[model samples]
Target chain A: MKNEDKDLTRRKTIGWILRAGIGAVIAAIVVKTSRRSSGGRLVWQIDPRKCIQCGKCETACVLQQSAVKCVHGIQMCGYCKLCFGYFKPDAPRLDEAAENQICPTGALIRKFIEPPYFEYTVDEDLCTGCGLCVKGCTNFGNGSLYLQVRHDICVNCNACRIAEVCPSDAFVQVPENDPYLLKELLPRET
Target chain B: MRSNILENCMLNIGYWILAAVAMAAPLTLTAASRFPQPEFDSGYVAHKMPHPAPDFAVTPMMDILILVVALCIAVVLVRKVRSRNWILFFGLICLGWFGFIRNGCFCPIGTIQNVALSLFTGVRLPLVMGLFFAVPLIFSLLSGRVFCSVICPLGALQELFIVKPLRMPKSLDATLRIIPLIVLSVGIVCAVNGAGFIICRTDPFVGIFRQSAALPMLLTGMGVLLVGTVVARPYCRYFCPYGVLLEICSLISWKQVELTSNECINCRLCVGMCPVDAIEAPRPALSDKVRGRQFKQFLYLLVFLPIIILAGAGVGHLAGAGVAQLHPGVMLVEKWQSVEEHDEDLFPSIEAFKRSGGTIEQAKMQAAEIVGRFREGCMYSGVFIGLILGLRLLVLSKLQGRKVHQASRSRCVACGRCFSVCPNK
Candidate 1:
């Protein structure tokens, strides 16, 4: 009986020592890692310059409807009479026709401002983010139309599925306070 | 007429210069004006870009508060209340909050990778993520694996599916338990080297909680839940990397759930009542000769430990080379090479690389560097695994006499089911 008591006490003391050791290790890790930590929440964003518009964003997201949507930088738009982002490259006419529209979903709305200038707006609800319009705009006109992760829709998965399959490696984590990485915006600012 | 032709030629030259500048410097041109916007006769103004705010229903602070409260309640219920029904009710609440409401983001299971990556790389661990990783471990050290019993949503989800528990063969159970340790080693290795978060990628429950996933992943989640009906918390038992840490902490916990408040009556009612089969039956004291044999076996294992570790390292070095192919840089280089060899039209990544002005040689060098890191990490992981296996064998060979039926310190999740079965209360 005396031997059992001594054994139990020895085991308890050993447990205490291990507990203290583990606690110290955890504290050290916290101190070391916190010094370098970015100290804010991060959300995934697509770098427009790197994005090759591989069309994976539409399919790879965990959401039923992808969070990625085309966002236009109006400042960068040329407001061309024949907008490559709006009309198909081989369109029979420049008029607003379903056959002549570049966007598969017709999410791009073209509004006439004057004789030769037109305005383009994206319908976020209808935009599938296939990047077909982005491809056309970047290749032929002022590359104003680009894809951005819609923060409101994005659940912000811990490791984004789209990021894993992104051909351009365009997906990057930005501070949640300023999430959009749109064209005409400097990368460093975000 | 001569002056008119000169003016037209000058205008064409100006347009050419503007187009060349636009093509060469897209970003700078965008920052300025690529093609000058036509002066608006109607005075129509361009709208400012609208940035939508992210919806955070339960903020990080709220998540931490709930986690702490659930853990505290779990400890009390398991230790003081000792009611399986209360634990079940509380676990359901945690499941709803952490699983469906939060969509399983920022979980302690996935936080292992974040902590690891932060430790080894420049990737900064968020404060909330660091806290999420550490708090459960701290609680486990203090009061056993109360976190597993009622706080972890993944475990709770599995617990809900348990219909009729089946007893696994002892040998099979022991063998399967090694998988979590192996997973922990590989997960840490991959995360530290910035490969990927294998834990989050392989999580079977996250898809179900979010109600969206690839077909394969959704099927996997369903399959785990279905098997859970009979097996009871199979993922927690054989797969969870975080559980490996919790097991270690709980092994040396300050306090753990006791089977009874009174003396043991040697009744076997509580035996096999544990859903997880954590109860160990009482054993007669071992003979001196058997102890001597075990001591001999221990010494033999000690002698062979280094050999085992070296063999493991050799296998791991080979497997690491294969695993390195999964790295994006390595995969990109391989794809580029294939495209070059076949004279194929440029793929998206290859085109992106060309646009970025990166040479193939530079890409190869980068891939080589990543592959080297993988090899080193896998070799170290192999050594660690081998050491764990060796130690486990040595411990198993050691003879320890027990006189009472009690919960296994490392295996028991402190669910308090055994307490209810004990008539001594």
Candidate 2:
């Protein structure tokens, strides 16, 4: 072959090799990611039942604010003036006093609807997932307030800090499909 | 007798007091005696969390296959067939698969940030993201930007609206070319510092792909599509950081598309026809002595390239603080560091951190770490931009000896518009 023809042939061969190399690399990455995650996406979630209300969710999250959030099942709530979630057991009076408030951030807003009834509403912005209110409510009153991994806020880190520190082993690996394990949120069609 | 009357009055008052306490007790207890509060009278239930569509949720294996196929098609069309019609078919098919079926979010443009995050930070990006990021560059190395020519859904969608071609002023076009560099730099810096992907967030096509998005984002997507009708591949030419990467690789590519495979007859037919205006006419030849002098001058510029890069690094480091502020943690800490100054807009993250018992010192420390990463990212970005600019200058000064109408490898997307116009074909 002439010199120019030889150069063209050489360039073509190198191009083919480059193409093959790219293909192999892509295949390798796909296999590697699948193998690493066990062929399924790992989603971080909190189990309500086994949670000890240890207040670790507030601090252990990689995000400054933990993805774990405190949610109140309105159906489970009693709207009581002397709510165990809202007030200390030995509070001096049935009033919204600093000493009587159980939540550290005052996230639980107590609204007087009628003569004797006060509705407890959680301002999620103010809630830190400390679970002080959940603990107080679960122990003294009917278990209503609970902690759940808010899907929007959670980055779904591979290794969850809340899970590691959870005393009751409440954290469990669920598919990315059904992420949140809310106490009253349809129970995953079970 | 007086003691008996006093005892009688006390007994009567005590009975009335007891009655009042008994009556108020039931009313004080809100769901008073009920253990479980009754369900709402309206009988509303919480809705299930939205799930990815059945068609959209393909296996990882399928993702790789689709990517490989698209890449192959791009290669074959550019190097072998070189047909404009086939290229248009390829774009339409990609628009269906990547734009509608798979969703446009998982694109090379978006994945640029993913790869950057993976390299700079410990973000575990999806495997397909790595593929989408790499395949385009690999294709560009062998053939040129065939991926941008058709396989890229964002480009394909824009091409469909390329009705009336309008020439963007060369000055504005050149200045706007700096955007992709800045965008890539800012994206990497912000992502490394735990800020979310800025590119993906602002992706104009994502809203249309998903069929639903925030109102503002949807409007922006529509606006880009409208502008695309007049200006061909505005995002691909000006905004896509991945396109910038492809351009860099394509410059050193083995083979590239030309206006004509055979010799050009000095035809001005292809002039003023390029959407991106990548075509450059052959300049008049210079004498050997002057060429030698010009070559020496170019060498001096090459020697000065490193100094240019270092100066850029300095400028970047100065601007690094602004980049760091994009991060939520840094923003929150910077605002709430004093703790005494009640910040008006108390973000949810800030409030949560304060309530979580985290100290101002800890938040400040995290912010400093993020800022450090941003500074490092800025330095690297500055070096990158400076290197590209210097190389571009070097190439511009060198005279092309060829007399044929040749394609500008870096700017030609290989959309195959000039193929039919060629007499050799």
For B1-425, candidate 2 gives per-residue lDDT tens digits of 78656754654464345335534555335322335554444444433333221223567558767878888887788677878899999889988988887657567787666566666545455555576677778778777888887888888888888877787887888788888888888877766666766776667876687565556777888888888888888888888888887887787677787777678776766766677777767766778987888888889889989988898798788888888887767877866855454662244455556545677789899899888888888888888887877776687677436666678989998888887677676
Q: What are the per-residue Cα lDDT tens digits for candidate 2 across A1-190?
A: 6998999898878866765665566455444433254333446677776676778788877556777778887656766656778876445445687776888888988887665566677888898999988876665555567888876666543335466445455787666566666665544222
Kindly give the number of clashing pairs for every candidate. Answer: 0, 0
**Any runs in candidate 2 off by more than 4 Å, and if so which?**
A1-190, B1-55, B337-346
Angstrom error of the Cα, residue B67, model 2: value is 2.0
DockQ by candidate, in order: 0.42, 0.11
The 10-residue segment with the lowest total lDDT in model 2 chain B: B46-55
**iRMSD per prediction, in order:** 5.2, 12.0
Q: Which portions of model 1 show Cα errors greater than 4 Å?
A: A1-3, A35-39, A187-190, B1-32, B340-346
Candidate 1, what DockQ?
0.42
Q: Write the per-residue lDDT of candidate 1 for residues A126-183, one digit (tens) a residue.
A: 9999999997787657788899999988988888889988877789988877898878
Top lDDT prediction, candidate number? 1
Look at candidate 2 and tell me the lDDT of residue B419.
78
